[model samples]
Target: MSADFAGETARLYARFRRDLPSDQAAELAAQLGLTADDLLLDLGCGTGQLTAPLLPHCAGAVAVDPEPGMLTGLRDRGLPGVVAVLGADTDLPQLGRVLPPLGALVVGNALHWTDEASALAAGAALLRPGGGLAVVTQGPPLWLGGAPWQQAVRAVLEQFLGPVTATCGSDAAALADRVGLLEAQGLTVRVSSWRADHPVDAAWVLGHLGSALPGDALTSGGLRQALEDELDRQTGPLVEQVLTTAVVARRT
Candidate 1:
């Protein structure tokens, strides 16, 4: 299945969606054996959150995503050694022919939206003999089971949206499934994880929720009011724990 973001949703994603922490990016680079000479491929590089940080570690980068708005945001950054492309994982074969063989391929928090096996195969085909593939995922959303305020936020979402499944594959079951799939592809898999706390205010929370949910769901229904009421009751800035997990594999 393909997902596209535009208009207000794209705006909210560009503004509020957090980037992979610099330190975490470094650790992931080390795991992938990334170097200054290797070309990096950031698949589904939404607004360049995961693309920007990984640029310095590699020789250059080609960031690709299907959404035009996301590509626009990446292009706006004008990052050196980075080129944003409008395409999906399935387009990588053609990309490989024009561009040099990639040293690394990264699917950051966007693998769940595509057919995993097909995407992974396409990515592996683009990588050089010993190149690596890193799937960077921020474990289950902060609002799902983290803090009191976030738990309250989850309740509000469920109340309006019914049972909610996170768009990003953040849960333990999903992680296990991903690892199994990668292993099945004849690639060696290794995982690294760490937790981070991000300061969040009402606006950040609202923008984050808006990016994930449809506009009408929040505005037309009573969901928006309920969400606002919950946020208003909170005492101070919510310190949310962002758990990041990186699954690294080699094309060997």
Candidate 2:
């Protein structure tokens, strides 16, 4: 992991709590075919965004992250069937020892941050025979139930992130390879993708980008003003985004 990632993540989590939707969790849980007897280990589980939705599908959850603040938020949610653990991706052996053999292991957008090979190796160890590993990445700017806003957000994000067409980790494919690793351990691997029409308000967009914006250079109001101006220039009055993804290998 990069030296700055942890600090950046803490700030991002504070912002994400407001902007990110829980619906993606439901989608992921469904895709993995989560069952009542399943024990899921959530990799890079941030503030229980994915953890909360998995509660209904699984008997229990092990939410892991290096950030204490993120775990605190998950705790604050008062979610049932959740056990939040603080650790890094390489700490999987310790995690495995803490939680029993898991039926499924999952990571949301943060899968990009971990060492893919190590993660795959660790996940293979954690899941029992025929267990599954779901590595998912979300991308493209879109608005909830608003086409115009979606266009606006896309334009703004492209400009902000600098010509990024999609959001996928450099190691996304390797992370998915965990399915093959599990297969070697006796599990069937299923790789797939899904789309969702996610919704969000202007405040949602602003909060999502808040922490990443350089506060020393621009005040909160200033950043908001800039974003509003950009949105106006890109798409005026109502926008909706098409939420797309590459979900690789949900081991069955």
The C-alpha TM-scores of every prediction are 0.94, 0.74
- Using TM-score as the measure, the top candidate is 1
lDDT of 1 by residue, 57-86 (tens): 998999999988888888888899888899
Worst 10 residues of 2 by lDDT: 137-146
Residue 27 displacement in candidate 2 (angstroms): 6.1
Error of 2 at 247 (Å): 3.4
Clashing pairs in 1: none
Off by over 4 Å in 1: none
Q: lDDT of each prediction vs. the true structure?
A: 0.84, 0.61
